[model samples]
Target: MPDLHSIPYLVGAGIVLLHVIGILHVIHAIMTVRTSQGTIAWMVSLIAAPWIAVPIYWVAGRSRFSGYVRARRSDDAELLKLSDDMHRRLREYEIKPDDAFGRAAQFLGGLPFTRGNELTLLIDGEETFESIFKAIHAAEKYLLVNFFIVKNDRIGTRFKDALIARAKAGVQVYFLFDEIGSHRLSRSYLNEMKEAGIHCSHFGANRHWWSRLQINFRNHRKIVVADGKEGFIGGLNVGDEYLGRDQRFGAWRDTHLKLKGPSVQAIQLVFIEDWNWATDEVPDLEWTGQEHTADQVAAIIPTGPADPADSWQLVVAEAANSAQERLWIASPYFVPDGGVLTALQAAAIRGADVRILIPEKADHLLVWLSAFTYYEQTIPFGVKLYRFKKGFLHQKVILVDNKLACVSTANLDNRSFRLNFEISGLTPDPVFVGEVAEMLENDFGNSEPVKVSDFTARAFWFRLACRVARLMAPVQ
Candidate 1:
């Protein structure tokens, strides 16, 4: 018989307990993990080193968000009524689906492609913010502002002042920000907004006690709606760096969209759902929007972990698969999952010109390094990669032939595909598509084509580091 009090016997028993727990977690990962590669990675790590992997997995493993689904489907009669009313009103402007992408996007977003809409492509920060501030100043009823990051810097102060000005004018302003993204924002800033009769809250996965450990998910959407008539969506957060004022990263190149008509209400609907998630109360706002003369066809697609399927990933893969002539994408992060990467390659192989634009500078070291690993896999299959030489390319844009163009907060990475709440505005209107095309053409003119040798010629240690960084892409 073993000595019950002996240290050696106790240590052995503890190790066995950990392994049993690890095995149970492995089963859980197998059942829950979204991708086969992710499942294999978790299974190996859990079995080989449970002591370290278990905690990390507990924090970041699960792809599906808890509590959010319940909150969205809550039996709150008022919320349900508002949703039904919004849908009914939107149906009046809904356009019939003319393509596979349209049908799939509508099914995934639960919103229709609307007519009588106008989309203005706002290039870079100054133009985008100017338009946003102008709309904020002109607000007659209510304003909804949301962003992934809202630094308390120069531009942030301007943004705050704009909201305050509108709020003091008797406009109901509801501001929402991501908790982790705006962690540096002072309490005073929020208090000041509250003092001016504005409703402000931070959104995160930590709303419930059980979800505190699931901090990996983030609300990465950047949105601004004014009086439910005009809206903005894109990559620029409220910060001085986005304005190209940061010396470290000069000339911030990004894209934003100024939307009008029925599409603006669609954007507002997304904001209402997000605000409800944060505050559990929906503010009353205008549900009807005036139709613009442009009459462009557009849709707003919002995707997150609360979704039943990996919505953004499927949307991107569908974009690639549906590309007839050319597929072009520009993003700050390019660490796509296996499915997206395969789709990109398949598009190139099927005689479609596939091109990816990325920034030359390293904003996130791991993400930048991970991108290098994709060169070999992509270039061999005829896909072209370009590095923006003029400035940091932070635009999340996609062009599928001359048919569809999209500006979004979603990136070509696993984080955006699964871990973050993201939104995109897509339009097939030829005029809007032409504007997007001209903008991308100018951006492409400022970029340099990347060759396979760019990665292969790197030093052995650097290449090895890149490969190592690629392993962390799923969580990044």
Candidate 2:
């Protein structure tokens, strides 16, 4: 009954439309894709197969986070003035030499390493939650809380209740969460927070339509800044698994840090910028100059796709490049980009002790499989890999040569390196570095050393699957 003769003409028209869309998308990819490999891959695919590639490009090709960038620039002049003022005030609190990380922070458009800060390493979830709750209860002036994932489970309810209590006590509470990461979060939960007087919003809630569809970019940072005096940042999120309640993960292991001093100011600034982008309203808080005693030196580096370059990625690479005695890293994921892998291999080849610690249990199948591909290439270069047996290892802590240490939410994978927003605290204090060293020592002790034979002895299909997973590394 259909027009059989018109089928050829209809097919020609569809082919023309697909080609037009594909060509336009190729130009867009060339203009927007951050990495050269990504651009070439998209261009070739778009030209080879128009229909399939065009849809895929629309969903995943974009790398820059234009929405947040626009929101950040809305009040550019005012923010610049404020930043200059803060820098002028921080000049007196700057630390002495042996602070290469301070220069790296400057490159990232962040504050320098300041003295007079006290740092406490919270080993796992129980200590982290306890310290955070106690700090929230002590909030008098203002409170800021942000996390990538905020579940409505046991720990999430506790976090919500703490904020509600503070809000009812006349404390100005500002809460931010990632809509994508917390997609399971209920509307009723958000309504309850609004009813309790907490100013809360999703990070990219009001983004442009096109940008909203590009959901790859995420605010993966977890932070809590209270009273402009203390702050917390690290890997643990507000969920029951983080507290080791989920039997699937068995006993969960992670790390967090609590800081009191000028370092808190640097962390608070990171929160303020994210808060401003989300709500487009600035809160009144203290920028008062406090006296310094030069107790400990630390800097906060916040990185995202909005930046001119990959600051957090460069941080990891530079640390690997600069290590002399040893380089130790523990992350839940280990899918490093070319630059980072090269840096680690070079570090090991140059006689530095290079060790990478990953979890025995995997939370993401693609990432877990892809990580094996790297083992074959790196193990021969004096790079040692270990797998934690106690439980999952989700900490993003790094120890560099017993002098520099980092703790943050940034993973070693491409997602944190380029896509997700991250905040890392860099410290050059030996005392703090020593603490990190001891913690990692215990972690490495419990972990089983991986041998090259492990992967070489795998089945044929298993090897093929690992290779296939590795092929998806750039996108994953």
Candidate 3:
């Protein structure tokens, strides 16, 4: 037998230990991974290269966010009571859903479709920020501000100054941001807001030792509420690039929704949960609903990894399945999971006017490449794809038949479906649907139809790269 002190013996023992650990991880992945493709992929990689795959699997493989769930369920009696009170107050304004998609959404989100809401579609950065800053400035009692990214650049400074001004005016301002998304945000930026008496904290997923290696999950919801009466949610973050100031991606196209009425309270509830997760304390804010003159019906759907199932994926699939006339979706990232893809194809096959609008310019190379691989699978079933030519399409808007429209922080990818904490504003009001339809019509007018040959006609290396990128979709 080899000596235990020898380097070669130690090396052999290390290899055995790694393989044993890899097998354990493989077991964990098999028991926990949500998708079959992801399970098979991890099984192969873990067995073949335990040293590399083990570390990666440790970081990105886990599907459940136990820490978040624990935070939500912990002895937080006050938070639970606040949530119960908010829902109790919203019960009077709740509208029972009559359609399949609506029912699915209501069941998945645990929030009812609320009436007496007025929704305004804010297109692009200028309009969104203008409305948000105005709300911040006008906030008299309190403000709830949260975003996935908050930069230290010009727009961010403007946002900071707006909050500071309000805090100085005696408004109780609470700010929350994703640590991963806003890693570049300086401590000085947060200090300034703190000095002005604004409460600030990052959605600290790494606060616990067990969760330190789990960085795949992110809080991607963008929300701002003023006095618990009006609110904003969508894809726009606080950055100059979002305003189309970056030379690399000019004319940044996006969308946000402004809400006035009971639904604003729903948005506020989401913020409360996130804030509670970030800083184990509940803020004092209004839980009552305010009726708007327009009297529109809307629901706020929040989804995340801590959920019982893939909520966003189910919502999108249900939307596709329930659409009878048209289903138009706009997102920068177009990579979809198998279930969602099948739903889209089935929607097309059932004679729905299925159209997917994606950006012509890519901000994420892997996700963009992965999108191409799906054309052959979808185009054959009459699902049409469009590439926005005027600018980069960063909006996450879904229009279902002329009846339902949604502006959400979630994207049409596995990341948004499974990894990120996201919120959506969904409405079935005719006037609001008409507005969304008009907005999408203008967008389609500026887009070019994509042909299946867009992928088939590409070179062998390019096609191979797309397939390789697609294999990484679960974590992307």
Candidate 4:
């Protein structure tokens, strides 16, 4: 009754439809994808294996975040007014003779390097969480909170309780987290926050039906802004694992920063934009920031795929290019793009002390393996490599000579450079740089230098596997 003789015709039609969809996707990749390597890889896969590749491409191939872009543009008028007001308030404490990095940060992050800001480095989970809790408890007016992952564990529960108490006290509290990154966060956990009168939502790439299938882009920022007078940002998310409770990654290593003064206003703006996208309500926040006499000049740089260009990629290369003496970097992942790699090689050849420190124990196997493929090309150019043997190194830090230091949530991988929403605190203060230098010195003391023989002596099959993983770098 089902017309069994038409089976061959149905199969033929399906094949034709697949190719048609594949061809359309190929065109989309060529026109929309920003990276040439990504475009070519997707095109070939879509053409050769449409059945599997088409779905994957539809979900992950798009580079520009249309929803965020549109939301930002829609709020242009209010944001412009806010920017003007902030600049006016920050003008009295403005620092002159700002370096290229500072200037670029002002333009890109829409935040200027205002003086009179106090910055303190919080090392690892114990110190970072302690600082954050104290700051949250001190919140008098409002608090802006965002993270990539917010667990329901011990630390997370403490964090929730603190916020709930503050909300009950009538201090406006806004909490935002990424849906994909916090997929394990129980619904009851979110409901509890809502019941406690905390404004909570998830930032995600799901504004459109097509985007609902796309989970590649993530909000990887971890920020806390309290009363527009203090702020925090860095690599640590809300989880028990970050506190060294997880047996898998024992003694987790990370870094966070605490800022008090005008820079907090900039961090507050980032949360405002993200919250606007989540709730479409741009609530009024304090504009004027407290000033200090400290000589520290800092800027908050926020980058994402919605940007006209790859911002962090350019920043990475610039850090290498502008290094007068030393360029040190530490990241959990070490998959640099071609431009950044070339910049590092050139800097090393030009007599700069270029060092890249990565964790020996990896959470992502492919990224760990792919890093080996790059050693042979970089090490010969005087670029030093070190592997941190003390647990998993998850901090995103960069030190340039004695002038600049950065603590950020952006990794040295394609994902952070292209796909994720990331923020970094850049400072030209000698005090901050000295602290970072000391930290890196201790890190280097604990790490073991990687030699040329280490990579060269790998087994043939292992080398082959690394090479194959390296081929996936564009998408990784």
Candidate 5:
């Protein structure tokens, strides 16, 4: 018999047990239906004692498509035109010499690759903010904004003010921010936006601890489209750190793209899908689209929790598998799950020039340790590694065959690949790819190579620490 004081705790445990049992039933049903290579013993245990299996699955299992749910039919018709425009860019590689990369860049991003999108890269965060704001101020009709981290800081306030002004001026603005990623924002900010007439909503931020099943699912997409003619994407977030004002990290090194073309429509569609998910509202379709160009301009690789197709991860896998000449990856967090790690090892084994870039200092101690331990195996495959001592090198850019690149908010880690909703754009334009390649080579120039000896020098406990963290990758 439990004491009266222990009732709540016991009840909580019992509820968790109940759910675990339910999940086991779900898993058993799924395994039986699919005839998976999944362990029969595990399935039996899951059915017999779900509590144990639920924890293991969360930490180590790959979630099947049947296990997750996607957006409903109400996910706005307004996205159709924008999606069509974006799809066209993805299929057609039409543009000037300024846009084309190497010969492979012409065909690498997939079928119908085109190179005609006019693009401008903004280096300064403050300048990027001002440029985007100016475009917003000048907008005549629509504005779509998406961000992974949208805080209520100085920039957020300014952005909010701008959106309110635009709303007053009658521009239809749809703002989408991830619930968990931007969890720091107060209710007041949202209330203020609604009051000011701006349409704002949050992506999956299920805080209910009882069943926050997909809290790992985050919208790591940072995009903006104005009047369906202009678009922007890249790593710039609305914060002082982005402006290089932080005393800790010296200069903020990041990239954001300014697009003047039909590609903007596709990015806009990405926003609409998320907006509809949050608000359950259908938007008007067939509005006048602003044409920015005819030359093949840009392409988008949309990623998220709602995608039933799991396209982004496949693209990454394909890029890794397709690397014949060389592969250069610059990511702040270099923890790739077993699948990606296997791909890197295989690519290196096949004699592809494989190199990875990570940050020098630890952002998250556990994640860093797990990655460092994994390095012991990677170096053996001739997979070179580097640490950008310049700052927190939080970049997720990949250059394959010295031509094509997948740049986005998605990190190479398992969290970004399978759990988070991330977006990246594909560029086949030789000019853009050339500039990007040069930038990567330059990064390798200044960064220090993380040698194998570095791992051996770590204290025994530190190495042990990473081994433990690795066990948690499945849940992450």
Candidate 6:
């Protein structure tokens, strides 16, 4: 098998490439790094087979993005410190489900599901803006605004301008955005905020190829809180498309919320943690005590790789299991995890009305393909699925018993469950929950359901390719 004939020429080419790399290294020291003998041993593994070795490093190497990684893992320490306390609060109550997804109620959303929380579902984008701005206008101590996509466009400009204004007004504002997801925003926009005294940080930015594991970890949550008084959460973001202004997406359908209660404090905590991670700026722990409104709040749930509460995943499972009359699901990306898919199928098999509505054409094709491959298993379990024929459906919501549900930033993929930091609000309030469920039903009615046999009988190779792609899918 040895082809000695061309070995000399191939060797010559490798030598040329190495020379170019050496020259570049001399120019900028981009790849050159300080090292010790032990460090040199670790470095050798990277050069031996970079492509394969790089990925392994990513899965196991140290993260240079996490500011505290060099110090100590604070998330772990805080989690352990409060583990016993969190356990007691968790054991306080059991979830109640008559016919919907929470029938078995494994999550135990505490004893008082809707007891002290004052949850409000905001139906108007304009109203959400006004509410958030009003809270920002009323900021006394600190303001935390985090978003995945913060463009320099119309809505984004306004939000940024307000934050800048608040910072100038002596309000402490921390802004956290994803590096890759929000890459479209120009340096000028960020500079303007910095000039105005706003403390900003980008989640997981530049790193060497060998040290860039979990680089895909994103910050997908959309939240805005002012002095922990008023909190805004849900699917809406700072984009005209979110406000139904996109010419292509006529009459955009989306959902957002303004939560006022003790839960808002929890939302603020996540922002502070992100701020600490990105900028190494320790936020005031007592900042949580300052509330704009002393309203009763619900879960105040946030989840990600750094936190292993699994509150988001468990919430989804409970919602699916508690499905009563119907379970309506709508998400831009519908690639569910094992526990989520199981609970959904089980609910349908148990005779709960289950309908899943996803977009026919989304911005991400791999996600769509993976979701489509599960039609056979899901449909056979009595799960009715619909595909939106219009534009992308970026909203993530679940309706169970038309009484309890959630609107979340978390996707069904593993990235959302275990990697990316995300936020979601789960509520048992019938009015808002009913609205969320009914809205999903309207979306389902606007689209066509997937024929079970037809989907199962697709071309073998197409299905096979999709199955293969599924292996590469994001995981928790």
Segments of candidate 5 deviating more than 4 angstroms = 1-115, 205-212, 285-297
In the range 1-476, model 3's lDDT, one tens digit per residue, is 76657978789889999999989999999999998888999999998899999989978989888888988887788988988898999999999988899989989988889999999999999999999988998899999999999999999999999999999999999999998899999989999999999999989843686686788989999999999999999999999999999998899999999999999988988999899888877898888899988999999999999999999999999999999999999999999888999999999999999999999999999999999999999999999999999878999999999889999999999999999999999999999999999999999999999999999999999999999999888887
User: 82-124, model 1: which lDDT tens digit per residue?
Assistant: 8788788988888977888778888888888999998899999
Clashing pairs in 2: none
lDDT (Cα) of model 4: 0.89
CA-lDDT, candidates in order: 0.91, 0.86, 0.93, 0.89, 0.68, 0.66
> Among all windows of ten consecutive residues in candidate 6, which has the lowest summed lDDT?
29-38
Q: Sorted by TM-score, highest first, which candidate order results?
A: 3, 1, 4, 2, 5, 6
Off by over 4 Å in 4: none
Tens-place lDDT per residue, model 4, 1-476, is 44899988999999999999999999989999998888989989999999999988877888878778887877478876776787888888777535775566567666678788999999999999999999999999999999999999999999999999999999999999999899999989999999999999988633667666667888999999989988999999999989989898898889999998998888988888888777777768998888867757888889998788888888888889888799999999999989999999999999999999999997888999999988998999999999998888999999999999999999999998889999999998898999999999999998999987888898999999999999987667
What is the Cα-based lDDT of residue 381 in candidate 4? 92
Q: How well does candidate 6 match the true structure in TM-score terms? A: 0.75
**1 or 5, which is superior by lDDT?**
1
lDDT of 5 by residue, 344-401 (tens): 8999999999999887866577677767877787999989999888766666787888
True lDDT of residue 2, candidate 1: 63
Off by over 4 Å in 6: 1-53, 56-115, 205-213, 247-250, 285-297, 309-311, 453-468
* 1-476: candidate 6 lDDT, tens digit per residue: 54899898888887666555434433322232221332343355555544444444446332123433442355556533433333344333323334433432223322223234466776546777777888888898878888888888898899899899989998888888887678898999999999998888886533345434555566788889877657788877788877767776655556777776545655665676666566656555333232233233245456664542445566677778766677777777777767889999999988898888877765666777788777877988898888887555777777767566777787777566555777877676676766676677677767888887655688988787678667556431
Report the C-alpha displacement of residue 438, candidate 5, in angstroms.
2.2
* Top-lDDT structure, candidate number: 3
The clash tally of candidate 6 reads 17
